[model samples]
Target: MVIFGLTAVVVVGGGAFVAKRSYDNSKIVPTPITPEDFGKIALGDLYAPDPKADAYKAAAVTAYKKDKLKNARKGVAALDWIEIKDKGPGGDGFPQANFPPGSNPSPGSNKGVAKTMLSSFGFGAEQWGCLEKLWMKESGWNERAMNRYSGAYGIPQSLPGSKMASAGSDWQTNAATQIKWGLGYIKGRYGTPCGAWGHSQAKGWY
Candidate 1:
């Protein structure tokens, strides 16, 4: 009987020892949390700084401020006063001398009329290019051109066509009259032909 009791105690103790060993082997040990690891976990890679990109941005800002200061020091001239009078041809105020002598473009050809009129609006040859492109896309320079969908008409494609009457009573039949109104409109709305053309290019209309 005593031998059997001793054998049972040894078996129980051995099973407990084996169970404890298994538990210890299966247990997961936690890794030590370092400061760097905590930073990565909380803020991710955002904690890292890009010195080159920061330097470039700082340089760009400094350059922009310097340029602004230079421009401020170099005072800008006011734009030349433009007077829209009713003394010239078609009762539009632009002076006759503004039109280059012998610039009588062929009747019904709107481009020649526009080129002659550009000087009156303070535009140069460079502006003529932009005006040409703008009108070509709008009406192909055809004085009678009409958009059936939008009801815009004339070489300038003035909406309702009557707006050109502000320049002359012959707005419908006269390319010169239409061109005058168109130039006025461009100056008022866009400041220049290139400005109008740029807007047209971006939005498919001016």
Candidate 2:
């Protein structure tokens, strides 16, 4: 009985070894890389050899003052799953590293201004919704957009929405003229196409 038990142990051990070897040989080693690994590649092997040190780091300091500068304020919003796609491989490559996704993209969100405009214009969800898309594409609501060629100008790409003179002459830098012409344009032809607004969504114009 002892000899039989010893024999069984050897057989089991041998079987396990064979199975492991076959499994190892059959498995395909994956060359796929993780975001961290890819990021390391991005900087070049020389920059961050020691992950712990992250040797190439910016030292923090206070009282920063500069003469010329451009800046924007970001907002804190719960990102939807779609944002993840934009931040990951699904997004056109992770957002420039360190910079978090959905960082306040502009100096201020247009939400409030848009809301006010909607109320003033008596625009319903669908109509103003179209207007919103138009401005977003026009000048990002710049309020100072100027076209070099056709000489179209202002936030709403007033074109000659400047003709909004009938509304009020401040048409040059007037958000009101721009908005008025934009609204009128939509009402006239598209009757709320967001005219170029819808044009922009379809062909990135307006």
lDDT of each: 0.56, 0.39
Model 1: worst 10 consecutive residues (lDDT sum): 79-88
RMSD of each: 36.4, 26.1
Question: What stretches of model 2 exceed 4 Å from their correct place?
Answer: 1-114, 119-122, 193-196, 203-206
Q: What is the lDDT of residue 76 in candidate 1?
A: 51
Error at 121, model 2, angstroms: 4.6
Give TM per candidate: 0.48, 0.40
Q: Residue 160 deviation, candidate 1, in Å?
A: 1.6
For residues 123-188, write the lDDT of model 1, one tens digit per residue.
888898899998887777766565432335667666445556567656656678889888877887
Residue 61, model 1: lDDT of: 30
lDDT by residue (tens digit), candidate 2, 1-206: 54344334334443342344336433534344467655543443312122211110100000000101111123334211111112111111211122244442331344345546664555666666676666665556644554322223455554332233444434444455456555554554444545546655653343
When summed lDDT is taken over every stretch of 10 residues in candidate 2, the lowest stretch is: 58-67
